[model samples]
Target: MFIFFGLFADPVSDVLLRISEAWPDLKVVRLEHPISAIAARFGENHYDLSRDKIPTDILLMTERLSSETPSARFLLLRTECFGGICDNRGRILLDGRTLFEAEGDGALRRLIKFWGADIGPEEIFEPLGRSFRWG
Candidate 1:
């Protein structure tokens, strides 16, 4: 995993958000927890743009993660193949895929081109194609 290889930063909030969106049928009581921020812990390097992902490493990781069940497999996709944004509306674009569950729930729109150096929202367009729609 990214942690064992020294890639440290907790995306707990993001993870919870994605989980809620992906499995909207389930209830997610995403309460806050008082943990130290990875930024505060690692500072500059935590958000470092220069940290490029090694192809072989990621492939190996993907292979390892894919060995799990569908639900678990989703985590692999979320971790490696997805880029999400909520737009100005309270909706989630799960890796630029369907987000019918969280309609009008959040209002923060963020454009993230990279989640490290390996993934982006634009990349999602390819796998899902134009067959998908926001509405």
Candidate 2:
């Protein structure tokens, strides 16, 4: 399960789209403001966000998600900038542990590839000719 906070920049958004395409069953939730509009799911667990209040602290948010989806793995991505280093920098957390402190889109792509390797398809074959092979 992947939970995203804030608006995703173009590069990050593209990577996310690729990931979803590669792993069709992966659950992804983008949490946006007003807080009430976001609906999230992880594996068999589903959440209704209409009445829920989101925590401002990252740790607390992590805890909340962990509790909601106990057995599922989680990746939290957010766009955050500090100390005037706001060059599309983002933070990534894997299972409540900081995977990348402050990194750009390239780092995110690598992280996704690494974590998604086993779960996603080993090979993606594009169409070669008029006849396409399924499987």
Candidate 3:
């Protein structure tokens, strides 16, 4: 099972589709409002931080969830840009350990690789006009 904590730079539908294609039997849940989901899944006390704190609190949440549910995997994605500089970050956690972490275009590439997707980075970035920072 995979739980997505936030929106990714790529389209949600496309990302979900790719994941499903890679793991047909895998179940995925996307949570736009993670606080509510966490409360419902693990009780309110499991997440005490406010929405703005999510970015920094993700690891703690993932660790707790992993301890409680051995099969669960957490994917957290977030992007920030300033002064014409953009940073896209992605983290994958399973069994209380981070499986992958990357920034910028590498984040998307790692995600595709993690899912065993046959598609290349060009296939994904092409639609976005390759707007993602590449170095």
Please name the candidate that would achieve the greatest TM-score relative to the true structure: 3
**lDDT tens per residue, model 2, 2-95:** 2223311122323445434433455444433212111222222223233122234534555444344333333443322344332223343444
The C-alpha lDDT values of all candidates are: 0.25, 0.33, 0.42
RMSD to the native, candidate 3?
Answer: 12.1
Superposition TM-score, candidate 2 onto the true structure:
0.31
| Candidate 2 weakest ten by summed lDDT | 121-130
Range of the 10 consecutive residues with the lowest summed lDDT in candidate 3: 34-43
TM-score winner between 1 and 2, please give it: 2
Model 1 has an lDDT value of: 0.25
TM-score of each: 0.19, 0.31, 0.45
Q: Residue 115 in model 2: shift from native, Å?
A: 3.8
Model 2: CA > 4 A from native: 1-59, 79-96, 99-102, 117-135
**Candidate 3 per-residue C-alpha lDDT over 48-129 given as tens digits, one digit per residue, 9 for 90 to 100:** 4233234445456555555444544555554344553444566766666777777676565565455444345542422122
Cα error, residue 81 of model 1, in Å, equals 19
What lDDT is obtained when candidate 3 is compared to the true structure? 0.42
* Candidate 3: stretches off by over 4 Å: 1-54, 80-86, 123-135
Candidate 3: residue 49 lDDT (0-100) = 29
